[model samples]
Target: AQSVTQPDIHITVSEGASLELRCNYSYGATPYLFWYVQSPGQGLQLLLKYFSGDTLVQSIKGFEAEFKRSQSSFNLRKPSVHWSDAAEYFCAVGGDGNNRLAFGKGNQVVVIP
Candidate 1:
């Protein structure tokens, strides 16, 4: 069984500050990891993914994430966040040959000016 845990349910950030959303996973073996963003009324958008090869991958909207197998963590980071970045962020884990993804509850981001 694979699961995702996002410790922070809500986050507040300044308009130009950097951000990091933590994500942890539990799985029997190596699993696929992904980050998705959803706006107020929009569908989920893929931010980035980690399938194999290098642990670090670049994502859309100046976002990036690193996969740490030893720590069982895949954290999302943004060098500088904008007001437009305010939304619900999700972390999901799939693979395992089941074609299923187990997602975290999500992190609600609020950008303050």
Candidate 2:
């Protein structure tokens, strides 16, 4: 079984500042990693994902994530976060043989001026 852990439970970042969120996973084989963001009254949105090939993947809204197999980590980063970016972020791991994904506790991001 695969599992994901997001170390930060809550994060506060200033508007226009860079933001990074840590994610670690434990799986026997190559895992499918995903970063999802959810805003108040909105459904979960796919930010980025990793399956194979490139170690780094880019997504919508200027979000990117790098997959580091050696460290069992897939961290998400944004160069300059906007107020709209303030939301709940979740890291999930699955794939290979697993059909279902396991998500982390989630990180609540609050953007301030």
Q: Which one is best on lDDT?
A: 1
Give each model a TM-score. Answer: 0.97, 0.97
Q: Which stretches of candidate 1 lie over 4 Å from their true place?
A: none
TM-score of candidate 2 against the unseen true structure: 0.97
Worst 10 residues of 2 by lDDT: 93-102
Predicted candidate 2 versus true structure: per-residue lDDT over 30-51, tens digit per residue: 8999999999999998889888
The alpha-carbon RMSD values of the candidates against the true structure, listed in the order shown, are: 0.7, 0.7
C-alpha lDDT of residue 36 in model 2? 93
Task: Write model 1 residue lDDT over 24-91, tens digit each, in one string.
Answer: 99988878999999999999999999999999999758999999999999999998999999999999
Worst lDDT window (10 residues) for model 1? 93-102
Which portions of model 2 show Cα errors greater than 4 Å? none
